[model samples]
Target: MGKLYVVGIGPGSIENMTIRAMGAIKNSQIIIGYTKYIDIIKSLIENKKVFSTGMRGELDRCRQALQLSRNNVVSIVSTGDSGIYGMAGLILELKKDEQVEVIPGITASSAAGSVVGAPLMHDNCNISLSDLMTPYELIKKRVELAASGDFVISFYNPKSHGRPYYLKECMGIVKKYRGGSTPVAVVKNALREGQEFQIFTMDSFEEDKVDMMSIVIVGNSNSYLKEGRFITPRGYKLMD
Candidate 1:
């Protein structure tokens, strides 16, 4: 049986992809991913059989990739770290007797933090606002805890068609424990060709301004604006 490589391409830019992912893609006979993401690196994989899917075809995509892997080396690419709500989950779920390897990438959460400044260096937690399969109550609980603990929060799937209200609800939860003046960055399409970075305070974030393509980062209670930048220190330690 052939092997599969679950690669994280990092946000929406080829530059963010790791050398290892590049190598894997080059060696793979089949490549699969969400259409828009695959389009970004289409030129790089001209020799491979490409499979693209839409938002709701995740299961179909995984199954097809697995079947392809049974005969040839296949690589399914995700936007961020495969462990953080990425395609690795679906691939593993579809796996029966096949082997797979996961290649990590710079997650949107981390890339967003870096683009906006250094707010992630301190306490931070990554959360997904999408409630397609998961319960909203759990997501709300996480926001509450992250807010109370003053942990910088990187939120994925902030909004979608019927789920636009999810982001608004999250804002309310965070505001309950944290101040409204807290820093928030709506890093959209981070590091991509058309990347748009919007800076706002927690109170200033209008839910309508955000969508599924964006990642919302809510700064911690201790997060401060310094040198015209948003910063969060991870708490210095003495090596001695």
Candidate 2:
């Protein structure tokens, strides 16, 4: 039987993609992904049979990929690490006995961390503020627990036109545990074209600056800013 490869393209940049991800795409006769992710690797997928769908079509995309993989080498692409909020889980869930290979790549949290500094050097957790698949109440609970535990937090799908206030609400829960001066980094389009980021404190964060393409990192109580870098120290003792 043929094989199905679920590949993470990595922040929509060729350089950021792992060799195995590229190889998986090159080895496949067909490629599948969300429309924007497909456009990101258009150069590498030239002349291949391509399938794409817009947002909210994830199930359809995975179904199509599975069907195609029965007869040909097919690759389904996700923008970041396949296992983290990517298509890998859905693909695996839908397949019964298909040969599947998952290729990992740089996730947005780490990519965003690199541009800002080592904000994820210590204990951290990623929570998606999007309420499509998850309930807002549960998300709020996760944020509260992560914040209370002093875990550096990275939020994905932080804000959107329809869900403009979700991030603000979550930040409110965070404030109960973290101080107003905690560092926050909003990294947009990390490692991609038109990339930009800004650092702000919990009290001064501009909600308008965040969107779906951005990753918002809120520092723990111990996290701080130094020399324009957002850093979360790993509790290492320093020798004087």
Candidate 3:
């Protein structure tokens, strides 16, 4: 039987992509992924059989990749770590008997964390505001709980044109527990061209600056900003 490798290419940059992921793609007979994601590594996949799918076609894409893998090695690509809101879970769930391997890559949270400093150096949680699979209320509850626990947060799939209200709703819940002065980092297109980010207090956060391509990082109560870098201390008393 042929092998199917689910590879995460990190934050759309050649530098951020893992060597293992690139190796899998180079070894595979075919490369498959969302068109946007495939575009990120277009220069690398040159001359390879590439299958590009559109938005909301994840199942179809994975099915195609899996079917093709029955005879030829296939690399199914996703942005960021494949298991984190990527194709690894669906590919595994749909695999009946096909040989599959998941290649880990840098997640958006980690990329965003690095860009904004060390907001996630300690305990943190990730939540996606997109309700396509999960309900908005459930996401809200999670945000509220995370806030109450004083956990640093990394938000993925935070906002899009269709559901702009979700970001506001989630942030409102967070504000109830974390004051308006809480440090937050808004990052878009991490490690990719057109990358942009800004540090803000929770009250000063601008939802208008966010989009589907953005990741938002919120620091816990103990987190603070120094020289424009947002940081959350990991109980290191020596630093004090």
lDDT of each: 0.84, 0.94, 0.92
Please list the residue runs of candidate 1 whose C-alpha ends up more than 4 Å from where it truly belongs after superposition: 237-240
Off by over 4 Å in 2: none
lDDT at 152, model 2: 94
- Let me know the TM-score candidate 1 reaches against the reference structure: 0.92
Error of 1 at 28 (Å): 0.5
Using TM-score as the measure, what is the rank order of every candidate, best first? Answer: 2, 3, 1
Report the lDDT of model 1 for residue 76.
89
| Candidate number that wins on TM-score, 1 or 3 | 3
Q: Give the alpha carbon lDDT tens digit for every residue of 208-229 in model 3.
A: 8888889999999989999999
Clashing pairs in 3: none
Cα lDDT, model 1, residue 185: 87
lDDT tens digits by residue: candidate 2, 198-230: 999999999899989899999999899999999
Model 2: pairs clashing at backbone N, Cα or C within 3 Å: none
What does the lDDT read for residue 107 in candidate 3? 96
Winner by TM-score:
2
Quote the positional error of residue 158 for candidate 3 in Å: 1.5
lDDT against true structure, model 3: 0.92
Return the lDDT, model 1, position 228.
Answer: 54
* Sliding window of 10 residues with minimal summed lDDT for model 2: 172-181
RMSD to the hidden true structure, all candidates: 2.4, 0.9, 1.1
Q: Score residue 113 of candidate 1 by CA lDDT.
A: 82
